[model samples]
Target: MTKDEFLQFLRDPDVCKEIFEIVKKGGKPAVVAPQVQPQQKFSSIADKLKTVYPNANAPQIQPQPAPQIQPTPQPAQPPKNNAPKGSGSLADKLKFLRGHLDKVREEEQIAAAKAQEKSPAEKYTVISNRRCPICEKDTRVVKTKSRINVEKRDLDYCIHYKDFDPYLYTVLTCEHCGFAAEEKKFSGAWPNKLKETLREFLKQNDMKFPFVEERNAEDALSLFELAILFSEMTDQSKGRQAILNLNAAWVCRCEGFADRERDFMEQAAVDFEVALENERWPINGISDDMATYLCAAIYFLINEYDKSTTWLGRIMNNANLRATAPKLFEQARDMWQDIKRANKA
Candidate 1:
C-alpha cells in the first residue's frame, strides 16, 4: 500500500478497534511471511533424484552457448566531397590578377551639399579589395557606405541616390577568372565538392569583363548573372540564390529595363516562395515577417491577389507582429489595403 493508503487504514475505526482488542487480550500481533512454491519441473526433478539415489542430489545440465550472428558486409562507400588541395592562397592569385588590370575607378563628380555645423555628413562610398570565395582572386568592389538621400518612397521602399547610383557597384568580378559574387559571398570557404567543381568550371570559361572599380547597371547585371551560375554549381541555399536574383532584378530596375526587371522579379518571387517553405529562418537578415512582406508585395506586383492576401492576412492577424516588427506590419497593412481598394475599383 502507498503511504497515504497505509495512513488511511490506520485511521479506520474497525482497524483501531481490532488493535485495541488485541492489546486488551495481551496478545501480540502475528507477522505472516508469504509462501513461495517451487516450479513443477523442479519438484519433479527432486522426486526423480530421491527415487534414483534415495537421498542424493539432482543432476546438473550444461548450458548451451547462444548462436552467433555474422553481420553482412556493407557495399563500398562513395568518395567524400571535400576541398581541393592547393599550393598558394586563392586571394594572392586574385591580388596578382588585379595588379595587371588598369586601375580605372569611377566616382560621381557631384559632391554632397554642405551640412550644417552641428550635422556631420558621412562618406557616400567606400572602395573595398575583396577576394572571391570561389576563385580566390581579389577584385575591387565599390560599396555604398551611406546614402545621400534625395527622396524616399513607401512603394518598393525606393531611395534615389543623388550623386551616385551605388547599387550598380555591389557585385565584385575577378578579371582573371570569370568568377563574380556579392561582397557577402567573398568571406566564407566553399564545400569541398563545390570548390573542386568550380575549379574545373573556371578552366573552360575565360574572364569576360575587365577589372574596373566602377560598374554600370549592365556590368552589375553581368556580374550578378555570373554569381547566379556559381550559386547553381554549389549547394547554395534557396534564400541566398533568391537574394542574388533579386539584386540582379534591382540592377535591371535601376537601368529602367522594365521587361527584364519584371522577369527577374517573377523568378525571385518564386525562389523566395520555395525558400519560405524549405529554407531556414532569418536568411540574409530576412526574418519570416520580412520574407512574408516581400512575398506579399511580389505577389501583388504579379497580380496574384489571392496569394498576396493569404500572406498579408498572416502578418495583419498575428497578435504580436505589430509590436515586434512595426515597420513590416505597417507595410503589410498598407499593401493589404491597396489590394482591397483595387478589387473594389
Candidate 2:
C-alpha cells in the first residue's frame, strides 16, 4: 500500500484493534519462514543408500527423452513487386511533374525579407557531404541541429517552428546525377533491380540537380516533388507515398498555400486508405491503428466529415481495441466527439 493508505489504515479504529489483537497473540511477521516439513528432512545415510540401490525404493522404469521435432521445409517467398505503376515512364512523369515555382517565388520574398535579420543556416541548419546512393557521387546534404523552439503541433502531426522551418532540409539531392530522395533512404542498400531502374530513369530524363548550400522554399518543394515522383514511378509502397504527401502538405502549409496544402492532404488520405485496404500490415513501419487515425485526421482537415467519422467508427466499434491500445482508443473517441459537435454546428 502507499504511504497515505498505510497512514489511513493505522488511523482506523477497527484496524488498530486488529493490530493490538495480533500483538497480544505475539504472532510473527508474514515474512518469517515457517518450520521445515518432515518429507524434505531425509538427510540420513540410509536415504542416500536407498537412492543408490533403486531396488530398495521400487522396480526401476527409466524415463524417456522428449522427441525431437524436425523443421518443415517452407515454400520460397514471392519476389517483391518492382514494375513501374505510374501513368507513363519516368521521363513522361518528370515532364508532367508540378513545379509550383510561382507560389515558391512568392514565399521566397517573404523568407528573404525575414532573412535580412539572420538566415536559417546561420543558426538552425548545417551542411555535410555524403555519397549519393544512386549516383555514387559525393554531394552536399543539409542537416538540422537540435534545441529548435516549437510553436505548435497540429492534430494532423504537422510541427510549426518559431524561428525557422526545419523541414526545408528534409530531402537530400545529388548534384551530379539529379537523383533526389529523403536522407534516410539515400544511403541504405537497394535491390539491384531498383538500382538499375533508378539509373535508367536518370539516364532517360536529362535532368540536373545542382548543389544548394542553403535550400530556399522552392528547393524544398522541388525535392519533395522528385521524391514523390521517384516513389510513384518505382511502384513504392502506398504507405510511403502517403508519408511524402503528408509532409508535402505540411511544407505547403508552412508557405501558407492553403489550396495546395489541401490537395496534398487529399492525396495523403487516399494513399493511406489504399495502404490499409490492399497493402500489407505494418505499412511502411507505421501501425495500422496510426494509419487509420491519419486517414481520419486528414479527412477531418479537408472537411470530409463523413469519411472521417467512418474511419473513427471502426476504432470505436472494436471491443479489443480499447484494451489493446487505450491511448489511441481515447484519441479516436475524442475525435468522434469532435465530429459530432462539428456536425451539429
Please tell me which predicted candidate would have the highest TM-score against the true structure: 2
Candidate 1 residue runs with Cα over 4 Å from true position: 1-124
Candidate 1 local lDDT, residue 98: 67
Best candidate, lDDT-wise? 2
Clashes of each: 5, 0
Error of 1 at 97 (Å): 56
Model 1: per-residue Cα lDDT over 26-97, one tens digit each: 565322212334532424433433332342222323568988989999899899633333543576656655
Q: Please give the CA lDDT of all the candidate structures.
A: 0.68, 0.78
What are the clashing pairs of model 1? 82-192, 83-192, 90-136, 94-137, 94-138
In candidate 2 the C-alpha lDDT for residue 299 amounts to 95
Q: What is the lDDT of candidate 1?
A: 0.68
